[model samples]
Target: MSSRLKRGIRRLCSTLSIPLLGCAPAERWEIPHFEPWVPEEFHPASIVPETKTVIVIGMPVSLPAVETSPSIWYHEEYRTVNTLLDINAYRIAAFLNAKGYPSVALPRDGYGHISVLIERPVAFFSHRHAAFLAGLGTFGVNNVLLTPRFGPRVRFTSVFTAAEIPPDPVLEDPLCIRCMRCARICPVHALPGNDYPDGLTDKRACASRSEELLRHYVSPCGFCIKVCPVGDDRKLYDRETMEIYDERKKEFNRLHRAWRHVRNYGGGERAPGMINKTPPG
Candidate 1:
């Protein structure tokens, strides 16, 4: 944002005592830090060699777009963010290297050590873990991370480096409302009743259901994310009916029916027939 626009925003915010919308940044400058975000005893040369700090970057999910058709728009948001993250990660690594510190941007999602990952039903590395350590947010019952401003409606990536940066304090207060809405709404009975960080969900069952949903082009099945009555969207959406889609029933149906074409190639790869359809409200 331009200086004038930023000043204008700050002035408007000053009138209302809003905490300045922590959900997304306002294109401001940030200070660098180097605290023990990662415990050295747990670190190994193989996982993140010469890493002194981990920088966790979180991007918020678009609100109404995600709420409109999370299965579809959230997938689109994920793909876009992942691509942007990849590009930025490389740039950050190079910048760190130039400053005489080796830095690596970890892949956000992938099957690392296929056998082990499959056997364990978990990724080798997790952005959620890094985010937790960085004080970015807390975890949800479904193993998804929730930020104070966005709840679980966010995606994160991390960069490990030899550079020492001060670490932010992990959030001490619990963010989960323990409403159990996420569990009751799961169509596949994958998520057992649980809360953030302390309880575990059936990962295998969750993955299986997500895979099944993939055929219908709703791989995300963001029931947990959508249902969480937190963040700004909660005021805009009704947890009872508009959790999965918008209040407009016909538009929601159109979006759901068109997913087979919009997500024809995993995600964000719209097929030719999908061009005529309007985006869900």
Candidate 2:
């Protein structure tokens, strides 16, 4: 390893509190305190010909605004979180490259189409799955990553490089409580009320609801997430704490109506529908 790279790893180990490493000239580029997961086909070699590992990062959605005002802040807040992650992903990739290891950061949620046809809305990769493999979180009933610290309230992106970094262990324990709260609470009945992978079976219904909301520019319904009773942030948005903006449908609509229709972030061009609707008086 170059002296410059060794110095960087030493600092990283110190900051991350990893054990004494490379004391007597160990293999170079083993990142400190980091064992990020490289899924079956995502090994660095597969992704970038010689990438030795993947570095995953997660940013969590805070309480209140994002969770309470799904109609108002849903997409807007999502944009904010993604923008932040995108910048960091790029920065990390650049950092790796500067250290002589070629690396590439994947685009945040808004970009990178797994399906070029637009009709099929899937990401080029599964950020949730990546985070889980990196030991950052696990899947929930809503098929969202339920993190130990953030529940399903996080957004993640990753970078791949040839740094020879070890991989983080996969979480053996499940995170979902099997409460089925997410399904029982979905306004659109999009969830099948089952556990991970199979729970979000009604993709068409979910997409249709989003398309409808796009006409008025209102944030698409994310009621399932808003009502999820997990994480410390949950209390910050749930009914018991927020008298006005909690996820209860009646009050939520009352609030949404007051805002009339919000703006869209993803789906293209408004198609028309709620033409004469007015904000609550």
Candidate 3:
């Protein structure tokens, strides 16, 4: 790619919060191979060695930040975020399709045909990493993918094809310094312990804890996003401020509970005209 084109692509990827740096050629990480559990049809004849096809797109999922609210307003916000994510994903898919590259949105269900199986040995070759290979973004310490725009706030889906596309070399950042802020913020300790080279995590433990939390109606805990230091102002949170907010949330919940009890058992009567009031004539 020309330097100017490369820079433009980097800027686009960054705007989406995908770290283009980690996808730079000099920093590409080798993916380990494993036997396919089930084989899918591979069309060697369809492979265009020099045609430059296949584009993987990452999809965003709603962060669990506002899930504590009982307000319908928060539910609407959740839907809005989800809609934006879907739109962004399909936009990329459409762009690739228009370019004559067959594209599909890989499902985010965790077990779709091209699912990102983080626990499996083949996870290093996952769709997220494929996007990383495609120069989309870098991996954050939370074991979740981080983009320059979204940080770790997004999930991923991908598309694959047999085009001879020039691969985007992986980018590396010396400034990363392995800060463990993301691990500290993970609600279920999904990240690896501090002392491993490979840094694999206990996926089942993490998933089970997330499921338990979701049962309480917190769909996806975004504690990692609250902790990542990179990204623009809107997505990033100050650690101290987040801590203070957590404290205040606990206090409010306590107060709400006490008020519920009083309203249920206390003999306090509704104020005059409050029980059933009509507009003034």
Q: By TM-score, who's the top model here?
A: 2
Instruction: Give per-residue CA lDDT, model 3, range 1-281, as digits (tens).
Output: 33443354346556766432222221122223311311222111123222233345444433333322222233345545555445655655455567555544433343422213324423312555545555556665666556666555555544343223446545455223366875665555677745222566567666564444334333333445545555443344332223322354444232133322232221212222321121100
Candidate 2 stretches greater than 4 Å from native: 1-45, 110-118, 235-281
Local distance difference test, each candidate: 0.57, 0.56, 0.42
Better of 1 and 3 by lDDT: 1
* Model 2 Cα lDDT, one tens digit per residue, 136-254: 77777787877766577777877766675655566678877777767876656778888766555476666666666654455455656655556665554443332333444534444
Off by over 4 Å in 3: 1-54, 58-99, 112-125, 162-167, 174-177, 195-197, 234-281
How does model 2 fare in lDDT?
0.56
Per-residue lDDT tens digits for candidate 1, residues 115-204, read: 343357755456676677677777777667777777887777766766655446667777877777778876667777766444677777
Count of steric clashes across candidates, in order: 6, 8, 20
Report the alpha-carbon TM-score of model 3 versus the true structure: 0.54
